[model samples]
Target chain A: MTTTAINTKQFMTSEQLLEHWQGHRNLTRRVIEAFPEKELFEFSVGGMRPFAKLAVELISIGGPALKGIVEKKMDAHDEESFNPKTKAELLNKWDEETEVINRYFGQISEERFQETFNLFGQYEFPVYQNILYFVDNEIHHRGQGYVYLRALGMEPPFFWERF
Target chain B: MTTTAINTKQFMTSEQLLEHWQGHRNLTRRVIEAFPEKELFEFSVGGMRPFAKLAVELISIGGPALKGIVEKKMDAHDEESFNPKTKAELLNKWDEETEVINRYFGQISEERFQETFNLFGQYEFPVYQNILYFVDNEIHHRGQGYVYLRALGMEPPFFWERF
Candidate 1:
């Protein structure tokens, strides 16, 4: 294998990491799917932020950050804004962004792994750190998803496997 | 606050991020706490992996990743050999890692944000991507955390807000 290909293979071979990412996204979709349209924005824990807001934040973070990576521009403020009033709308946007993530991820060159870029024009960090941040940010909010699921007494997807 | 401080406040602010991170760990801990010890290791979703294995993965990801960031070493493969035996042990380790993250984050200067680093010695992603991955990975698994919580009839943390 070429050196770049070999390196990619070694990193991409992390089944757990891949599974973890896909699984979490799948689960987040499920949680959104499970919520009643009204509850999406109203649900909270102790006057905390609403799941809807958090979802928007997640969507906002991914595409814009990727854009920042691609364009090598730092967003000084909230980069992308999508306000979906209904569950269907949010899901559609979610799916669209998911595709964006996959497409962007596919475009990542091994040579650019160490490249530094600014996200939101505020923090100048490396490309890898931002990517991990995207995944980590998603998982963090998805934890909230679990709470919402439990509150609704709805059975969420099985946690053991990501399919 | 000065303009620069104001401009960079969001990126420099680790409080919300840390809250999200800690909140996730706490929720995941709850998932494990709710499960019967025997089932912790045996429970599977759709013939997939068990929650216990997933937890181990979470613990393994955090410490070494943070260490990598602090030390500015990208090719750290120390995560491969980490395996914690008990829930308490993992929790203790997690607590320590949380502190580590806080300390490391505090020490990072705004000027140094763009430094590049490798993750797992494979991806040539930047330092930003690495940090993002650290948090994103946690969120992914934490989604499973919701599943586990639901299965156990326990309420996970609220999805919308960090407390």
Candidate 2:
């Protein structure tokens, strides 16, 4: 059988993928909430960027990438644009972006997932792969936040409890 | 349209999923290789488990879970079964398990991805979700390893360079 024939069966619906991504996002938001303001901004092990900075990087990517995908715009990637001076401000932007994600994500039809889209004018891949990268990148960074929390003698939300 | 109808288009092929997962495994192996022998087992921040122990947890999960799925076995989850004293020994077992993953992963029919499998007599999820958990869990721990390496003044493999 041809590759296309064998792959005709769905691995997941667009809605299921959105739910999965949002679940991870919810868990990440909790990780951000677990930190004290000082540690979120200043704590680091071995000079790695602080958890707050990591959160900023994620915030920069998700909504912007989805907007780019839907709009077919390859704007240059910008990680420095959104600077949250406090945890509360950061959380507000995060909550707002979640809505941005929901809106742009809904605009992607099933057929669009298989089409290649150059993400942020770089890293060209199928739309689904780009979306997977967003989720994967979040998990990787949240993993770092988990370590930071542990090192601070604080408990992070369970990794599996992505609601 | 019914959810099933909307989902008829493929999100990814089984082989593509395997490739994506193995890319992660390859990067994780690099993380293991970066650690000093003593630190791999004994290093910690805030009493978190060392990278070696985290690696052991992953080693215990992936191949065994696939075996359980292919053979219809639900053996109790065991993280303490394989203890590696040295980095060499750990990498050896990692290589063996990679082959084991390749072998057993091949036996799972595409249709089986949707079937519910109670993994390790613990988490009951669709086989694909269980597999994803394995990958997600690996990335999570590896993220910790990245932090540990940074703290130790060592550089981890780039998160994006999985291959």
Candidate 3:
């Protein structure tokens, strides 16, 4: 009898995925810190929103979305709810949200990751995909931040140096 | 005897991952198409590199990196080689690279993906993480493209509409 090797290997555990995501988060937080206080709030490229606004959008989504996912609450997307006027204020919120994400993300079981959930009452996708969306969206914004930093004649964190 | 369900289910197949990456690529291609020829090459916010240059970086990496992975070639990264002068020329190269990615990506066996690869003679990582890096990097640059498009008063393709 001839048989093929059915690949049963796990690609990544949930914990590994979390670590990978948090690595990106750490990089993004650095990006946020890299910006000049005034520029973070006031810089723009080709009429794009400043990095501060972009960072706020991320802050609004990640921890809240994970909390929503864990709690099974499909609250409407809220970009305007949290507004920080200063860099320190924003970073404080960011740290708080990081803790929130860690708490909620750990609560998701492997099976639940396969279940479909409507994120923020829109963007219906599997729980894992939703998490991926959060990560992907963050990376995209961080790329813009890199550009913004370069325009400001400052160096942003290296993309591959995520630990 | 009591036993717990050992979560052996797969999160995504290699095929599914390919499709996911391609979806982002399709969205990015649309962004490239949306840019005015001059603006694509010349536009900047805060002195960041132009979208054209960023697009070239993607082109330089994706297909070649995949080929390198499949062939086990540790060739150095090359971003300065292909110089497309027009939008049409760049798009053609993009299309060609897409095919190249498909071809090389398929050649990697399931076991091989778990192997470590020194991508571009730098950035040593497991093959799967290397692939993830490519996707993440693309999303990041495309994010910059979104800002550029908006600054020009043109609507970008929705980030979620990747198909």
DockQ of every candidate:
0.10, 0.57, 0.39
Question: Which parts of model 3 have CA positions greater than 4 angstroms off?
Answer: A1-11, B1-11
Fraction of true A-B contacts recovered by candidate 3: 0.43
Expressed as tens digits, the lDDT of each residue in A1-163 for candidate 2 is: 6556445544555776787789899999999999999999999888888999999999989999999999999998899888899999999999999999999988887778879999999979999888888999999999999988988889899888987
lDDT of 3 by residue, B1-163 (tens): 1113323334545665777788899998999999999999999676677899999999999999999998889999999999989999999999998899988877777778778999999979889889988999899889888878877889999888887
Q: What tens-digit string does per-residue lDDT give for candidate 1 at A1-163?
A: 5434322222221222333466667777877887878888787654445677878888888766776677777756572557778889888988898777755654445445456777787757566556656766676677666566566666656543345
At residue A74, candidate 1 shows an lDDT of 70
TM-score of 2: 0.94
Kept native contacts, fraction for each prediction: 0.16, 0.57, 0.43
- Candidate 2's error at B129, in angstroms? 1.3
Question: Sorted by TM-score, highest first, which candidate order results?
Answer: 2, 3, 1
Q: Model 2 Cα displacement at B34 (Å)?
A: 0.8
For every model shown, what is its TM-score relative to the native structure? 0.51, 0.94, 0.89
Model 1 ranges off by over 4 Å: A1-9, A13-23, A77-80, B1-163
Global local distance difference test of model 1: 0.61
lDDT, each prediction? 0.61, 0.88, 0.85
